[model samples]
Target chain A: MGDFDFSIIAANWRFLAEGLRYTVQVTLTAMVGGILLGTLLALMRLASLWPLRWLAAAYINFFRSVPLVQVILAVYLILPLLLQFLTGRLIPIGADNSAYFTFTIFEAAYYAEIIRSGIQSIPRGQVAAGYALGFTYSQTMRLVVLPQAFRNMLPVLLTQTIVLFQDVSLVYAIGATDFFGAADKITQRDLRPVEMYTTVAVVYFVLCFALSRLVKYLQSRIAIIR
Target chain B: MNYHWDWLFFFQEADDGLMYYQWVLSGLGWTVAVSLTSLAIALLLGSAFGVLRTTPNRWLIAIGDTYVDVFRNIPLIVQLFLWFFVLPELVPRDIGLWMKQDLPYFVTAVIGLGLFTGARIAEQVKAGINSLSRGQRFAGLALGFTEWQTYRYVRLPMAYRIVLPALTSEAMNVYKNSAVTYSVGILELYFQYKQIIEKTSQVLEITIVITLAYFVVAFATNRLFAWIEQRSRVPGMIAGGQGGK
Candidate 1:
């Protein structure tokens, strides 16, 4: 107990902060990109066309079924190779960038499900009213449905984003310098596993716990009137 | 495509005289062991804590809530890392060295995985119990059954039945999260992924094979849980007594 020295964390705060910045950056990128692609996937899955529905279902199922760590590694290794095979050139998407792509696509599967549920939660009459107004299908979704769905599902979406934030740590498998990975590196270099990992755990707990509390509050406040 | 595809690489010998497929199988065994053992821990702990949260006692509820918050909010990998590396340092010198040098990595991974998943299962259990109508609790109390007995008989069984579907998903997640144990260098399937890839330099094939392996396990878990859910279902209960799907 006496050996507890947080000076290690204090000395390396900047390095740790850089890692924290990368983690947040990836979370935001994946959040925006995943939600975009996820909305597309959700629409496809909800479409009348069987082929589009099937394709979206397959993508969601395949990604959701695998571990995030494996996909991080797979994308880190396989994505570039597949690209080179098709394009005849090796595009250098580094491990860090690879984490971005993997999380975006992988998380899109989950976000798609959330979005699909959100869309489902909106009554059929709302869509019908849009159609009754002589609005086109795309127009109804873009103008009437999506905005409402986004608001109604905001709490759930934020909860998932909190999950995504924690998941950013899985990039450690592919050697990305995320917050957890930064702590890991410092631990290795300084041989102070106690201080480094403890600090990381405390930071993660405070952030996630506070965020989840916010989600709980929002769920009560912004819940749609049924 | 400049890649060489060797479908027969699994049959090749490694340095330890085991075929490459044997190594993969060994890793798979560890993965299964880690997940199944952790599931046992999770179910027991989750049920206990789950009941704790729903109990009338404020003290018990506090303990359960604290457990859920601490374990669930922290990423599993961090928990695993702490349990694996920093735990020993925090303990007394002799025992710490023993833990560092003597404790099996498999046990460490399972403890971390179990506690983390247990917190999640507790939440599910709490929800399941909460979803039940208030009349049932009142009826149990009117029957002169003590609070513990009432829970032991009436609430828990129905709660388990009600939340079997959610439990199934958590069970499947145990398999997925087991991959994180690889970071601690346990000889699990993910660890072997690095091994086979490094040894044979066959990235694409091995990656596909491992991914398929994970998918199969997860899919099977889903099906098994579906079967269980249907079998133990009570008529006119949640989901209108329909299939869990």
Candidate 2:
């Protein structure tokens, strides 16, 4: 309805910068943590032991089935109590810390599935060859299978990271001042809801769009010829 | 550490004569309705744009790409806020006023969610179509079918079957993403959880119940799609294997 103004955002650049920093921090942290935990889950899901497989399956299924907002809320509330019980000391954890923990655990479920499929996509002969080479089971997975699987799944992993970036905004529900939350605060303070929201939306779009392009480039580069 | 769990709190009557479970159930209803309605919009528009992207026309592809890039990149929460607060002001004055004052929150949530998810679905639909061999499209054309008719009779049917697994995941994603509507003041399941937590101070219990409710919905959706995928499988056509968030 009116000409857009970027001055409001420029004036609050520091707040926006801090929010952006937090967003990037949480996203990268969750990506690493999620992938690490997810790889373990993926390994467990594929384990020879039925119990380990079932446990891994159950964890993935439960987390994947529930909405992530609930997970964030649950973690935000339950984690402190959990830590208190474990350590016999009350630890006051902030929403930001809980958001970090929640996203790591929650995203691990998704990454587990992707990694499982990635591992599965490797030819069975590769595992056989590793065994023929007298490699231990763990070494076969670590040194032989995993290297190929990572290449196969790199694009999907990066795509999921883009999604993780978008989901970082949900931390706002827990009162963590991530990018979206900071924008909302500016909206409240400046009485410029439209400009604040639009600016944040554009920022998110640019970040995600760039990441998606990266995913595309990786996909083309690593595409295996059948 | 001394917090007591009150599982029976859900049965307690509120000031409005409805029990907490009733509130939760109503919220679940809205969640289901909003997700389904928006999913319908997403699939319809997504398929149209997807088809346009696959067409020979450059302009159509550009339009499709623009829609996907713009909608797919922005966070759903931001989009919902835009729909709820900003979209009205951008429209014509009278219509904008009507939208601001008279349009229901539910409708606004659907528009926001539908368009956001639609962008994602458009990409999936485009991928589905492209996965097919070019020979299939040429076959349809050689059989004297018009381009649209060729797509209708040959390409789309095969593409839909091929992409059933991906589509299943997208369907579940839409349902999960609907939770973002809580930001726009829609009393979906997540919002109900917030209300219960605020009223009873039973954050843990309420979180567990809502989490279970969401799980049930998502699990049921997954099963439904899996069933469809099984029934619709074409013998020679390779299934697009499961897994996408």
Candidate 3:
């Protein structure tokens, strides 16, 4: 029943900016950490050692099966206790840190699957060519396979990143003051839930839509012609 | 800091005369109900829009693209809040009043979750349809069938079978995404987990149990869909590879 007010948002621009900063910070951190760990996991799953493959598969399956909210809650609550038990001292793994770690760990499973497919898409003859030219397993993966895989899967990776950006909002469950959370706090304070939520929704839609279009463009550009 | 673990705490009855496990069961019921209902909506709407996107008509494709872009980009929690709070105010006054007064939280959650997920499904359905060879469509048309009948009998069945793996993942995603409905105050499993944690302060045990419950649901859904994918798969049709978690 209340009229929309842009002035409320204008007055609180600083708070919203801080929230956006934190959201971007967590997203970038998670993206880097997730890709590193996920690539390792994908390599492990494709490893010659059965135990290594089993361990990697189990980790991916367990994480993939559970909801991200559960992972966020568990990490937020349990990581501190785990640290305390292990070291007999309580470390302050704050909500934002917990959110970052959880996103990294949870998203790795998804990225692992994507990266695995990318790696597989490379012809076996290429790997054999690497070995045939006197390369170790690690050297072959690094020098040839991984670079090509990254190129092949760039679109999927960026698509997942867009999904990750949307998921960053879920950090609100733990009160991390991401963009959505910042808007939510304003709503609570201003008693203008409709305007605040509508603004936040529009912001999210624009960001995600733009990112998806970029992904599409990348997909078309880097599309490896068979 | 010296908290003792109470593995049996879930078995203990609360003052309300129900055990915590019972609360979880009821929460699971709501979760399943919400997920399945939303999935039904997603399939119907998603397929419609997906098929529309594949048509040669420009306007229909624009409508499909707009639907997917609008629904898929916004986060589900935001959508849920919008449905629960802003939507009623935006509609006609009488209907708005009825929505605010008579519409249940479950209905709101379903609409929010369904439409949001329906967008994702629309993308998958479109991809599945596009993956089919043009020969399949021509073959259907050449068989003296109308376009609608050709789609229903020939193209759709094959498309659904091809996309079964992606559909499986979407089914599991719907169940997981249902957790977001807790934002709108639906007493689903995640909501119940928060409630129990607040009252009991047994965060670790409760969270572990909730995680396992979600895992079981997702795992079962995965297995069920994998089975369907196996049965319905065409012998050598691109292997029906799984994608999109």
For every candidate in turn, the CA RMSD to the true structure comes to 1.3, 2.4, 2.4
Tell me how far the alpha carbon of residue B6 in candidate 3 is from the true structure, in angstroms, after superposition: 1.5
Comparing 1 with 2 on DockQ, the higher-scoring candidate is 1
Task: Give lDDT tens digits, candidate 2, residues A45-94.
Answer: 99999999999999998888777777887788888888888888999999
lDDT by residue (tens digit), candidate 2, B1-245: 76689999999997789999999999899889998999999998899999999999999999999999999788788888888878776778899899988989888889889898888888888998998889989999999999999789998987887777777778887768888889888898988888888789887788878888887787788888787777767666457343322
lDDT of 3 by residue, B1-245 (tens): 57788989899997789999999999999999999999999999999999999997899999999999999899888888899888887788999899988889898889889899889899988998898899888998899988888779988888898778788889999988999888888999998998898878898788878888888888788888887777776666666544222
Query: What does candidate 3's lDDT look like per residue over A108-150, in tens digits?
Result: 9999999999999999999999999999999999999999999
Give the chain A TM-score for each candidate.
0.97, 0.97, 0.97
Give candidate 1 misplaced runs (Cα > 4 Å): B238-240
TM-score of 3: 0.95
Ranking, lDDT, top scorer first: 1, 3, 2
List residue ranges in candidate 3 displaced over 4 A. Answer: A224-226, B230-245
Evaluated at residue A65, the lDDT of candidate 2 is 76
| Cα RMSD, model 1 | 1.3
lDDT of 1 by residue, B62-136 (tens): 999999999988898999989988899988889999988888888888999999999999999999899989888
Judged by DockQ cut-offs, the docking class of candidate 2 is medium
